[model samples]
Target: EKHLVLLRDGRTLIGFLRSIDQFANLVLHQTVERIHVGKKYGDIPRGIFVVRGENVVLLGEIDLEKESDTPLQQVSIEEILEEQRVEQQAKQESEKLKVQALKERGLSVPRADTLDEY
Candidate 1:
């Protein structure tokens, strides 16, 4: 059966569920990160996944019937990748400004990754 899994790292993977161990480690085939930006969306193929149970935050099945009715425009993987990169750069710049402002006021802000691990 096909499944949509959300990981703790803020990534969503969609694929066929081949198996799951007693610990809930999942085996998925034909996996992909279905990304959306604005009104556009794209899928980046990720062959397979043997996800450790601890990393999974949520797991659910996608209804193929409702999937076909999404209003988002489907775009090429390359286009979506480029857009994602640009968005990240913009966010990094914004974060830098915020950190700098805090520093000027004698306050400290932790690195983005450090804040995300919890």
Candidate 2:
């Protein structure tokens, strides 16, 4: 069956289910990494994947009939990637401004990527 899988790292993959184990690990065939920016998306062929269960956030069967009816436009890989890069940069800039604002008010917020010492 065709399946759409969402990974913990915010990646979205779609492919045919080849195998699955009791541990929830999955094997996907003809996989594609789907990148979405705004209302547009692009699919990059990923071939096959053996995904660990822990990295999977969600998985659902795809309805073939409805799949083609998506309201989002499908764009070329290069276009989607460039858009993604711009979006990421904008987000990072906003985050920096937010942190700076908090600092100016004498408030300190831990960085998201930093781990607290035990």
lDDT of each structure? Answer: 0.90, 0.96
TM-scores of the models, in the order given: 0.87, 0.96
lDDT of 2 by residue, 2-78 (tens): 99999999999999999988877999999999999999999999999989999989999999999999999999999
Candidate 2 pairs with clashing backbones: none
TM-score, predicted candidate 2 vs. hidden true structure: 0.96
- lDDT tens string, model 1, 1-118? 8899999888889999999988879999999988877788899899988899999999999998898898899999999888888888999999899999999999998776678655
- Candidate 1, lDDT over the whole model: 0.90
Give the 10-residue window scoring lowest on summed lDDT in candidate 2: 109-118
After superposing all C-alphas onto the true structure, candidate 1 shows an RMSD in angstroms of: 2.2
RMSD of 2: 1.2
